[model samples]
Target: MKTFIYKKYSPRPNILHLYEHVVSIHIHEQLRKMGYYCYVDYAIKAQTHDQGLATITIEVYNSMLETEWSDLLLWNFEITDALIQIAYYQFLAEEGVLFTVKNANLKEELEVEHSNGWQTTKNIDTPKDISGKDDTALVASSKDIPLLSYDIVLNFQKKEVAKESYHDALLTLGHNIQVHLSNKKGYYRSEFSVIGNEIKLSFQVIELLSNTLGQSDSLIATGVIEELIESEALDVFIDAKKARQLNAISISTFVA
Candidate 1:
């Protein structure tokens, strides 16, 4: 259904990529073995940028009616949507993955129901089902929302600035860094983390900010960098500048 779960913002594009592989390849494989077919892919078209606004989606190949499906998949009227995503939200909040979450909070009540493998708890004599990350359970969670959530929930809301300004700051970052971010694409984080309190906060020149964000997509990806610097989050990758070279716009799109 191309269900866009979140308009996530963050700085680590590469980390995000690895996460997608885990879900689409590692976790989804288990589901595939069970006979239920589904599709999972995040940051659909990154197009090489350091910062990005990636799009994450999960689609089920099943078009069967609810009556035809097991009670586990019959969640909130969705066949496979909730089944695949709930575990991920739990992971991010618990794992400290360094990103923020939004929207799904709109469906806040959608938190995990049974922690013990989603749990085998049942009493009223409804159709029996066990949910968790195990293969034996008929009602199991996809258990990959950190990737899905990471891909979809960039959490740009953490910025004190408005989203438009955040994007504008990124455009400036692109021009200065000499990289480009397609307006429709997701912005990713840098290769390093800024969470350590005493660590030398020098921005890791992962790609050598050749333009000085110069390291290709590393700087241009102003997606969802969870770290902050001097109250200006964009500085986490490269310093903010006017992006003044008029012709530079051809190489990288920016208004400053």
Candidate 2:
């Protein structure tokens, strides 16, 4: 079992109440229905409401992968995507109904094999402003294996701070993330690519997490605490692991 943490102090203290387990659980159930499995462990410190500090731990696993490890790292992109949406709701609740928040873009491309052995691709359209994006249903069809590509965009307002924090966090954590599907090696060859804002966001998140919380602390800081306890994404992963015996799908099919 792997653990993820994100610890950050919000400039606006008013949002403190929003970080509670209740809200996290609410979000978890919503995602669970969407096919995510979730579990949350948290503690509240301090006697006063405003002075209290909250720390949460999230553990995730995908039963489909047939491993004791959790896919939360991969699902991070998807759950963060949903968290951004929920944040909008919080934004609205704080503001009035007339106010609007700009949306982020989360473009995704998925590769699948048709029953006839032909490769098929699908593109999903989401809000122009989205935080994290990943392919959710890759192994659904027995005819085709699942090769997924994820893309995520940082909120323009949070770009500078976010980038710094993301990079710092990656350095502190002593961890590396490799999108193997895009690598041109071995049995898998892929046309998939990661550049521009998508790459930028990954770095930014790492830096932000590092600056706010040390390595492991940062993972807990990034609302990941909320994600683990309140995500159905884990449930889906568990189901997927049981359903598909295959390891990750091959990317070589798309090469020209």
Candidate 3:
């Protein structure tokens, strides 16, 4: 398991509550993509003499076991990325909502650091004007929109299948099927020319995980197969490879 420590100092005490909520939601969303659920425990400490100064500490956890720092570093980086975006969005919102409070100047500073001594700090700034922008769209684009890519290979031992058959198989499976064919090595190749009609399909997982939360890689693969079956796409491919049937379908995911 990995741990991240977040500290914030807010001159306006009320902003701490809002900051806590934003950070918790953002962290939970990011961890959900990695098949882990998370919870936050936080506390606010009031300064003894200073009326408006308060310190907040938030602790975040997930289900991953302790592994090499190099492996865990990527996950930490993603969490950090989400924190930065959340801070920016919250700054914009606070600038609008907290403008009425007396001496309500929002001076917020956030510091997030991982266990490995990696740290980042952001000083929230008030936006000049957030008049007509959609907050939901801004947040969705920054965090919820998952841009993922993967390689899927469909193999069949059948001989002399048409090239167009490969195209039809993928189209029947899903929408916006991006197919890149090459005759060169170290690139995606189509068995349409080599043996039978085989296709190397590259596409996003969001389409496959549309019906389900993309918690695990296995879930994503199972969802794709289920969708294909429901659309009768798998049957079409099987009929095309009637001579020998499909040997295997392999998927390897790369999250970007």
TM-score for each candidate, following the candidate numbering: 0.21, 0.21, 0.26
The local distance difference test score of each candidate is: 0.27, 0.26, 0.33
lDDT of 2 by residue, 1-256 (tens): 4343333222222232233322343334444344443221211121103232223334444443224333232222232444434433332322223222123122121101101111111321122222122212211122322222222222111123244443332221111111111110101111222232222112111111123222332222233323332442222223333212212121111101
Candidate 2: stretches off by over 4 Å:
11-14, 19-23, 38-54, 63-256
**What's the CA error at residue 186 for candidate 3, in Å?**
29
lDDT of 1 by residue, 148-179 (tens): 21111111223344445445444433322211
RMSD per prediction, one decimal?
Answer: 18.7, 22.7, 18.0
Model 3 TM: 0.26
Model 3 C-alpha lDDT per residue in residues 1-256, reported as the tens digit of each score: 2443333333433343334433444433343333332111111121111232222222333223223112232224333444544443333332323222233222222232222222222422233332323222222122243323444444444435555655444443322122111100011111222224343455333332334322353344345445444444345444633423433354443333
Supply the global lDDT for candidate 3.
Answer: 0.33
Give each model's clash number. 40, 52, 2
What C-alpha lDDT, on a 0 to 100 scale, does residue 212 get in candidate 2? Answer: 26
Instruction: Tell me which of candidates 1 and 3 scores higher on lDDT.
Output: 3
